[model samples]
Target: MADVMDIVIVASAFGMDAVRAQGHLKCAQASRRAGAAGFEVRRELFAGEAEAAPQRLRALGCAIAELGLWSVFSTPAALYTADGRLDAAALRLAFDEASALGARFVKLQLGGFVRDAAGAEIAEQTQDSNVRLVVENGQLAEGGSLTQFVGLFDALAREEHAHVLGMTFDIGNWAWRDVAPLEAAAQLAPHVEYIHCKTTMGEGARRFSAAPAADDTRFIAVLDRLPRDVPRGIEFPLDATRVEADAAHYVEWLAAV
Candidate 1:
């Protein structure tokens, strides 16, 4: 029989520093704007350095499939501030750091809403890194529109750049565009390399949502439609209190998949 497919829940949202706390390692923080709740690492932590964290994760008895590298405001749009354009250099550094740590993928935002020279430059630098770049289709203002994002996918899918680039489609982002998550997944499934399943709950203006990433009906429908080879991940943010409980919920929900 084929091995059962498994989904990986990345722990970076809990802060790199949280990895040291040992108490709140599985805390949910994917929803935070700052993504700085748990632990914060000033430098990269490689496979050897991360062994303790991973071992601790294993002891929790939850299946962690793989580790993900995450960054806040590291996109092309964020490269330039009052100082100068540093997106390329920063990305190179970040990618190398992620790669050194044995991370399977690196998650990044496009920087800003506008897609200009800086955006192009950022994308170019990502392509140059030779590591897998998993683009998150969230926060639409920052070149996150489905149409524009697909354009990037198409460009990257070309013969010359196809192997080095791909996408990490975040299911809930489309809901903000008023597009159904399943529909959005259908549209981008072909270009997707990984998946982060979550949901937003709002109607006519005032709406918020939550998740057991793989449990939501909309997310399940999207998963049903997707090719099984794609790796799906659970991502959500919760306060420190819900860490263990939420991780258990996530593990149970993932098993249902």
Candidate 2:
């Protein structure tokens, strides 16, 4: 068997609708009970704006820390704006929110990133922060395409800014962009420090996030290519009725895989 990876249960996997109904506090308890090594808090999942306030986040952080699970903060906001400029205010808020939560990493989408001199600014913004930022390939071509990632990383490298940025490689996201996961892993694995474990299930092109089956060779193949030391997050949907069992099962299975 290969080395086991740490499993991080993304709160949204419990279902966005369900989370909105109960809030993430309950989910955090379940995650720790399932023996997850970490938990990912979705910014978009917060029930209200006040729930994400700094003081509330600090309290949540304390609660999570007491459970003995490390955390990662995820924001739906993209790292760049539509015009290819760095969303500095968005970036700063993300860091503040993640920092308040005492998270190890803040995950963001690589949005509208056109290669330019602005890539270097990432280092300056992150230098004083305790939390690190890792950009993920989203479902669209603008920031989610393989070519886009390669270009962004390349530009940052030229400016010596690559060291400050890392990737959250989502295996299932490639399908949305019509890109092959294995091919992406082959090129982007070097920069990947985290993984989102997902496989699509559908009757046609309109697929949805589903847990990878035990015998799923495609998931294993892509996972094998990424860094073994990196953490794996269960981003796929968990059975709503059996969230406990499903969460526990994947937490163990994903780690062993």
Candidate 3:
């Protein structure tokens, strides 16, 4: 079994966009102070700081767990030209960023079919690179649903790319899409290599809250179904004034898991 204490603190939880607007150095420093095993790096959070960000994070003893990119491969406008084809150039850039960050995996949202030519191309391209690719369930329609993920993985299996591809399951995202977390967990556990731990409250306009919220028992069920070896991390909003304390609480909560 894996030690839950190894839970990472995702940078975005701490107002990452705002931090990026200012800088990434502070975010890295703060993560270290909070005693996180590592931090998930979103491309937006390192806009102008990518060159120096890795070194700074390393200096503070923070590892780069994953590199997040926001490309919708299904949409020609997003990753391809008007002719409607995979934009190898854009895809390479995403891989390049993941490589530069030294992340174990490049995490992306599953916005389309894995059986698509572009998706197959992604698997082939990634096989030659050090950084692995993982698709996550995003909280919007564009992101894809649990059913879509199952189909994607099944297709990857048929193409023999399932061994190379994996998943990053977001606990709260199931709620966002109106899917029961535990049900999704049972179906996606086999491919999950990373996890996003957070709880959501309300219905139409849901909001993020720390894990283990009184009304949210989904985490308990989902956690039980997850592979113990995977990296499970907190991805909820953090109180800036109590960053360290908030982070510590999350770690402690995971420890008790």
User: In model 2, which runs have C-alpha deviations exceeding 4 angstroms?
Assistant: 203-205
TM-score for every candidate vs. truth? 0.62, 0.97, 0.79
Better of 1 and 3 by TM-score: 3
- What tens-digit string does per-residue lDDT give for candidate 1 at 1-257? 22244455445434445644543223323312222211222233223445435444333223222223232111222322333333566566557654443345555554432222244555667655545666667655454577766655565455245445456777766666777767777777777877666677666466554574443566777877766676656555534576555655664455457
**Candidates' C-alpha lDDT:** 0.50, 0.90, 0.64
- Cα lDDT tens digits, model 3, 132-211, are 76777877765557777787678667766667677888888887778888999889899988888888767767455555
- Which is the leading candidate under TM-score? 2
Off by over 4 Å in 3: 1-5, 47-88, 114-120, 206-210, 214-216
Model 1 lDDT on a 0 to 1 scale? 0.50
Instruction: lDDT winner between 1 and 3, please give it.
Output: 3
